[model samples]
Target chain A: MNNVNLNEDQQDCLQEIINVAMGQASDQLARYLDTFVYLKVPSIEQVSAQHLSDTLKYEAQSVAVVSQGFFGYEGIRGEALLMYQPKDSDRLADLLGYEPDELSVEEQIIDLSSILTTTFLNVFASQIDNQMSYSAPRLLFSSNADNNTSSQSSISEHIQHNSFNWDTALKVKISYQVTDYSFNCDMILLIPESAIINITSVIDRILEEY
Target chain B: MSANPFCTTIAEQLNTGILILDLDYNIVEWNRFFAIHAHKDAKEVIGKNVFTAFPELPQKWFERKLSSVIQLNTQSFCSWEQRHHLFELSHTRPITTDSHFMAQNCTFLPIETDKVISHICILIEDVTDVCHYQTKLNKVLDELAKANRIDGLTQVFNRKHWEECLDKEFSRARRYDHGLALIMFDLDHFKLLNDTYGHQCGDTVLIETAQKISSLLRLCDQFGRYGGEEFAAILPETDLIGAVDVAERICKEIEKLVIKFQDKDIRISTSVGVATINPNDKRYEDLISNADLALYEAKATGRNKVCSAKEIEYILEE
Candidate 1:
């Protein structure tokens, strides 16, 4: 619908908020691992789910995937994704004293990936929502799966067929390393087009509020 | 479907305790699991106040939470991971035409079974095994951390622990703008003693030396073996004059110790160097370097003496 466009100042403000959110996420992951975790803001762009999958192709094959949906007041919707290498998952399991292969997909909530994802997303969502003075983000769903062979095709197809209602978009991709472990992950944050416009207006309102 | 008998049979066969409470917080049903775990039969528990049957559950809070099931028409769940009840349980409440509660790993879930709206169910699961393992894990970690910080031979803090303590003390001194002093000492001709006797006798001498120095220092002081035949002490809130006095006392004590090894009366001596910290000094290395220079000065002038960094610096200037 091309509902609204984010100007330069709004874009910078959004990036700054995302930076703070990712920093909190990194701290939470570090605590879960009982070791220091590093996160960096690599690039921020506006793209569709199909393009996101395409851009992350090199990492998609070898990565452990975690995704979650966020809903705010007035039907504000967005998603967050974290992609980590299998080696990273194994290291995480080792830190938690679990055998890597013993972790079951159905019982995902008890695993290190889910525990960390839940905590990270909780911190990220709170930081963003509080800054915007929006309603607290409600967690719609969460899933962590290995997208090696069987799931990749289904995910790609789902992305291709789905029609998003978002009008303005903002995307941020971060690369991070964990200390004392040979593991890394790509943290991706996606805001729907309408939400981005809402955020820009919200920021202007905040400037006036202050 | 008349599945009550089957459900009762299954509940009786299970290992964990199960209880069903109505919206009024009265015991509607009790299973063999409860009879075995709680040592109370179903007949004695049924139709009684749930808290009265246990006497351990919070009477007021339990009633209030149970009342919410029918009023809110929603399921309430509590996990044992948050805090354990009288009996650890994972509890769940299910909202349905008839409400039921399930406990998982030490929880209590009570359900409402009203005809119009049964929206709450509770479930509780025992988590004694997980709790036990967690306690054991914590104890083992505490022991491991202690072992890592202690010296194997002397039963005192080792060099690694000493360094960590020094780092903390240095930061504290700088933060509070207070004075700290370090005393470094080495046994005179310790290699010769090891050669003359044996390694075991040398260890005994080191232990004895540590004990002597520890007895002479104040309770606020910390002492640790820095390396082979070498030891270091940290005296918080002590000035240079106080540190030198303590160092001199330690040196005299060591010189007086007589060790009987293989029927030979062996007299041992130690050279000590004392240095007061400058709060502005950023690196711990500087403190150690100053102490080492003072120790060398003590050895050069004559052994069995205490030297301060200021004296060593004056000598260097001369």
Candidate 2:
């Protein structure tokens, strides 16, 4: 924990902010779906840029991923990924008012990802007291259990392409479950080394103000 | 050459199928590979809705993938393992296998305009050969496993497999408290026959004996070559009487075998021993040994006769 770029205090602070942001997002989602949203306690860990895949590893041929970029203050930006099982798409589509068929399921996934990313990033930005902007969410990369051959490379490439020269990453993982349908989704926030430094200082300022 | 390379060559000349769709899911571009494989002209597809152009495409899945790609502005992939084929293109590989449609690996990439994704491009790679080879590998592995369990000469369960079957049957009989019987038999004076004739004649006699024994066995009975000039049968749900009756029939049928070897009349007979499940028989091995002891008695009394473990028990008591 000490070796992590963010010390224990900063990591805890980040986790606290993420927990609050996740709660707000979950409540919003629960209201939108007219169903209960189960949220797992969020955890944040500092990982090397190259080791991001290990930190974000998902079961092969089992998950579909959607990611989008968010801009933070001072040249800091990171991507947020929402991953879920393909089989859950049917239930999700039904809940989101989309017909679960060959045509509209992927669109439903995007709609779900966008709503989640939007709600999470908004609360996170406001909690940290930083002005932020978000790009339209888009499908970054997807690989399933069957084609595991390229999944590792796909994740690595996505991280490498997005992470840039940032050496360390603070990976935040949160789980959301639709209680009625039993569908689960993992929301991963990859904050780069530069972004965490800025956020840590922001946490220090907030603590000092308190 | 046109100033715009994308318009001139890249999309049209790429080997893999390239399809561009606008935000409304209308087809904006169709490459040569897509046109040829799909057997449709680019002019017909360029401005039509993607779902309308390929009605057979999984519309919901395609729409979901496209929406995710467009919304996230990222690349997404679909391998043949999840869905065999995206397009309903007929298989065109030189060595076509069982698959009717072309196997594909599809990639959806967002095409951005002014920092906003205006269109999505789908890249399709024909992976029929990969799927075909994987299927063939599985089939070959299956056949190899079957070959390992079967005797090459007699086409019956090999010794190893027979032992496994006997152990399984023994446990089932004990668990269900049902009767189980074993029959152990050997050709009468097999070595003498082998010495008088050649190994070729001995092999023929062994194969014929196995055929006659197997043909008389019930479907539930398991028959296998135990070893050189020896054979065994496992009869589940059968008592000593039923086993003895089956053994007697096999002995009589084998006795009637008139195998012709180079125009010479070669007669053969088998001596059989029968044993049924009992409190004393703890394992399949114990049952087999009891049957073997009965077989030894049959050989001692005469060359061609049927002996039961109960008779051996009476003899031991005497």
Candidate 3:
């Protein structure tokens, strides 16, 4: 757990694989919502669990968050988190064909996040030659501005537990935003030290092939 | 399909509900707990499509959920809190539970055979008790929050909460330079009525008076019990004339109200003082003090009536 020092070739291979996976995820999301989704090139970095909370600059203080964990046969293991501000929840609910209210907003977010997370994780796992079993999608963060319950602490706890108490772990950020809309969602995948080793070997095989 | 005695015994005897479904969603195995809850024996459900057995199941969503589990080869969960219940099985204790359907927390685990998932095992745990208690707890918490902001006797905003609203209105008025008014009123002989009858009769009077005044005010008005025998209201976007009109309406309504308490009829009146925001006033408390001065003018001149702070200012100028 010293550091995740990926060589130039390995980084390129990982990024290329992530691009295809992320593209598939976006395509599925666009079709499901019937709107255009603009995605950034997914970035992979190594970060400590403690600094993980402060790692991303959150646009809104209160956000709706959906997280799901995936366990695979061939070393693909991690938790995927989808975060977005629920300010434009009315707009989102409209797209989902629901009257915008607290419950509808929550329901819509959970449904949309599951679609994004499932498509992304399934494609990513398949690319790495791994078959995954996904945990049910959970709305872990409260979107209530008045509710300042320890949401940050809960998220950090999930990150810590999923990282398996690794001193440092590889964090892959797959961020997206809707075109001509106010929605910005980021999907983060935390790969614990053990899973990273498995991924590295898979990467090496692909590298050997090319 | 294991014919092992221990596996069979534990599967049949264990309290937990268990069901195994193949990739095609055919019921490969249904344990005793599951069969009992689903109201179908193993022989009835086994080798049947789940949707065929339970037509109430949302087919499309269920199909998508099952496919996600199989394709990922990953375990997924459905909690009672999220979707209420997956199977919609009737509650076992119909007499005890108000719920028609028992709440269930289902776990979908892909049963891997040689690194290939052909079937999925679903574990359903009855969480009816948890949902019931959690709902009750949430209701109690909501009532507790309402109790903190409301006066139990009058059922209006209490003094602390009323003042908070006034402060907010005061700042909003200053920022937007909008019209804001305050009305303070108290029962003229509330103490005499309590002494003659009892505190319960006095309580009835306060409750009725508050209801009457609240009915007269606009939706934007914040009405509350300020103190003993006294009530206050913050009228947003109201001028002196509008404030006086509302005060007069409350005054006349209270004067007309006759509460038929137990063996007697009790009648009471209120002295209302109206005040508007002045340019010189530094805080919302100044508005309250001005309204208090107008209330004093109404009480000093005669008992049951409405007096305006503007009238007091005109008297001072003369």
Candidate 4:
């Protein structure tokens, strides 16, 4: 399991922030998709390399994942990942009125997924970061494939072994539900715990000034 | 003190529509110009979804403009010339104390206010007349482009156009690994025809000959007036044998035509040189030069005959 050392207050604050950010993200996505989107509070947990596959097994095997990097106060930097099951991907394609069968190339699929993920993440990051007067959120990277392969094995192994520094790890999870289309998936925003602490301190300082 | 009369006067005098929206996107103020052009009274539009007030706007366009303002906190503008909107408008957002937008030339600008951080302002301007005239100018330019490719006298492809055709055919031949043939022909003793029948009669014969040859050629084949008294044809996907046959046919047809000029019967003939392009050949100019050399050979051997580069090679060998 990835080590998480958050006190109750910090956990509550992080959960609230994630909730608001995800809500805003869902709203923006809904506007783009032209469909109602419902996102749920994700089940927060620490998982090891051995449990990674099991954790993903309950989710769809064929999934579209988007990842981007964020940086904030005091050297805070981490990656945000949005995952969608195959069914949700189909729904997304339908919402966009794109013929899935016609998009055969990997480059085309990645471009389409990245466009959506960038728009959503841009909104989510801006809303959360703005409260502390942070720098404008920049989208570092995005992909829509099960990219955790051999090269990422070391990082996965470290997480599974609980050997990574907890102070530098913070993970937030969000699940989506579009009941009208019967589609759902878990979205994960992973940050180093130390980065979260720094961000929280900034927010605390801003709140105190208010 | 009376509200600055300049604000009201300018707002009313503008020809394009202008509107000021609050943070909630409700109209805080509307101008007379918008009321006249949009066909809606300002009193009826205030406090309504700007989109609802302008239901004719495309949903995607409306959403994109609205989002740019709300999220980026910047003014957005759209031109009528970009597409035919109900009104040609420009939008701008104001930088003043109140969040307001002014539309000019179909653009919208929103001014931000402190209490609400009025995120957007828009401006609009109408440019329908300019767009219409621009379209007319573009059409004239297109016609001019067509005119540039045709010969003024014969209404056939000119020498300049022939070069373009040959270049295109050469590239196609190389790409498809197919044969392309160039045939160059000159009216036999054309200067004598001008001396005997007058230049006007000679010109008539040239035009008639061009018409007859063009009738025999396929749509994909290009025939052009190479210069005074000379013409060239680019036959794509045709080899030396096919080009030789076409040249002979054109020669026989021209010989049969008895042109009556100045009450005298004149018989005209042409000498043709054919060259088959090798797909491996890199330069089209070399191919044309080879065809011209063969044409010189045809004229030397006989005034009215068809000659191929291979035949010229054989004669030189002899």
The candidate maximizing lDDT is 3
Give the per-residue lDDT digits (tens) of candidate 2, residues A79-186: 888888776775877676446553345556766776677667766777876645665465544543333333443444555356446677878888888868878898
Q: What is the DockQ ranking, best to worst?
A: 3, 2, 1, 4
Q: What is the fnat value (0 to 1) for candidate 4?
A: 0.00
Ranking by TM-score: 3, 2, 1, 4
Residue pairs in clash, model 3: A132-B72, A132-B73, A132-B74, A133-B73, A133-B74, A134-B74, A136-B77
Better of 1 and 2 by lDDT: 2
On TM-score, the candidate that comes out on top is 3
Each candidate's B-chain TM-score, in sequence, is: 0.79, 0.78, 0.82, 0.75
| DockQ, every prediction | 0.03, 0.07, 0.15, 0.02
Q: Identify the superior model by DockQ, candidate 3 or candidate 4.
A: 3
TM-score of each: 0.55, 0.58, 0.71, 0.52
Q: Which 10-residue window in model 2 chain B sums to the lowest lDDT?
A: B68-77
lDDT of 4 at A99: 52
Model 2 interface RMSD over true interface Cα atoms: 9.2
DockQ-based class of model 3: incorrect
Q: In model 3, what is chain B's TM-score? A: 0.82
Question: After superposition, which runs of candidate 4 have C-alpha atoms over 4 Å from their true positions?
Answer: A1-210, B1-5, B19-29, B39-56, B68-77, B86-105, B108-122, B256-267, B279-282
Model 4 over residues B1-318: C-alpha lDDT tens digits? Answer: 128989788878886556777666676677776676565766678778776776656655455546644643323334332334543232232242121232223434445456345634444565545555555655665566667788988888999988998998898888888889999989999998889778999898888889888998889999999999999999999989999999999889888988777778888899999999864467999899889999999999977899999888788899
Instruction: Give the lowest summed-lDDT range of ten residues in model 1 chain B.
Output: B92-101
